[model samples]
Target: MTQALTLARPYARAAFALSREGGRTAAWSQALAFASRVAADPQAQALLGHPLLNPADAVGLLAPDGADEAFTRFLGLLADNRRLVLLPEITGQFEELRAEAERVVKAKVTAASELPSAELDAIKAALKKRFGREVEIETAVDASLIGGAVIDAGDVVIDGSLKGKLERLQSTLSQ
Candidate 1:
């Protein structure tokens, strides 16, 4: 995993620089996401390293509409280099760069059960205030949490889940 990310960093950085300069960050984001999904598909995965597959065919498979000249060229380069498998990692790093540039942070919120919109909105508001940036919340329900929620915002983790509290208490008692 780490190796893949390391290999993908330069490609992601180059793509990000191009998109930033072109003022087409969102378009590039969509294109990368689409290409990543295509590359991740089972059929595409099988074809990635096939000796007989043409680079143009691979690029066409991943980007049917040819989003733009730069993106098409980028896809061709990846296809030529047999680096299609790295699309997901590249897309992720690109998104991180885009988010940082846009002053947006993605927060993963895990709760015991589905949270109401009002509660989610309140959490978003609080997180926005805390991070001083736009908060994009992605929520999931984990019954094992028992109660409360856990907010994972990059380096900051607020473990309010009952399971987390119990674990901390147990650790303290053990010490």
Candidate 2:
């Protein structure tokens, strides 16, 4: 994973730069996401690795329909370099770069049960105030949480779940 990220970093940066220049970060994001999905497919893996596979065909296989020339060219470059298999890593890093550039905070909230819209909105408002930036949240239900929720916001993780509290209490008592 370390090596993958290392190899993919430059390509991701290049892709992000291209998107920024073209003012099509959203388009690039979608196209790269689609290409990553295509490249990660089992059958596509076999095809991409085949010695007979050429760069143009590889680009065609990976590029989404209606992709812009710039993005298609980007895919061609990746294909030419035999780096199509790194699409997933590149896409992930590209998203990180995009998020940082846009100053958007992506977070996940896992709770014991489904949260009401009002509660979710309150959480979003709090996070926005805390981060002083636009917060994009995704929510999940985890019955094992017992009660409350866990907020994972990149560098910050807030474990407010009863299960987490009980575990901490137990550890402190044992210590």
Candidate 3:
């Protein structure tokens, strides 16, 4: 992971610089998503390990149609260097770039079950009201929670799940 990040940092920085200048940060996200799909393909993975696949051929294979030319050239560099496997790192870096530019934080919330639309909206509204910035949410289900939800956003975690309460009760009883 460290090596991948190290390898990806330069490419990500270059892409970020170019996209920011054009005010096309979302383009970086889309391009990185496309690159991620290309990197994850079985044939692409195999090709990454092949000694015979030159950079230009690899770039031709990985570059999807409709991609921005600048982004394509950026991806070409990675392909040429056989560093496509570090795509996840590049995505993470690009996300950071977008976040820094937008001043919005992305958050993930895991609950025992699916949250209703109303509840999710309320949460987002409350977060926005408190934080004074747009909050981007990603949610998932974790059945082990039994009930309630655990919200993690940036440095804050609000653990309101039944499982957490139960553990706290157990500790109190034992004490």
Candidate 4:
């Protein structure tokens, strides 16, 4: 994993520079997502792992079709260098660049059940007030939580779930 990430870093930095220059950061994000999905296919995985498939053939298999020339070229370069397996890391770096430029933070919320719009609105309002930034929230349902919700954004995690509270109480009593 470390080796893959190290190999992916330079390519990601180059792509980030191009996207920034072309004012197509969002486009790059979409392109990276599509490329990553394509590269994640079982056939692609097999081809990537096989020592018999040379760099050129690997690139041909990975490159995107018409209408996405620049992105296709980027994928081709990665594949030709036997780096197609690093798509996940490349995607991560691209997202990091986009997030930094957009000043956007992604907040993930997991609740015992789905949150109502009103409750989500309240949470959003409080998060906005606390962080003083634009936040894009993604919510999920986790029945194991039992009740309440957990919010994780950047380095801060506000866990206010009944399951978490009970676990803490259990620990305390045990201690």
Winner by TM-score: 2
The C-alpha stretches of model 4 lying farther than 4 A from their native spots are: 50-67
Candidate 3: list runs displaced more than 4 Å.
Answer: none
Please give the CA lDDT of all the candidate structures.
Answer: 0.93, 0.95, 0.83, 0.82
Write the residue-wise lDDT of candidate 1 on 33-96 in tens digits. 9999988898879988798999988888887474888888898999888888999999999999
TM-score for each prediction?
0.96, 0.98, 0.89, 0.87
Please report how far candidate 4 places residue 151 from its true position, in Å.
1.1
Most accurate candidate by lDDT: 2
lDDT of 3 at 128: 82
The worst-scoring run of ten residues by lDDT in candidate 3 lies at 58-67
Candidate 2 whole-model C-alpha lDDT, 0 to 1: 0.95
Across residues 14-114, which tens digit of lDDT does each residue of candidate 4 receive?
98888888777777888788778877888878878788877767656655554256766777778667788889889887787778778777799999998
Clashing residue pairs in candidate 3 (N, C-alpha, C atoms within 3 angstroms)? none
Better of 3 and 4 by lDDT: 3
**Ranked candidates, highest TM-score first:** 2, 1, 3, 4
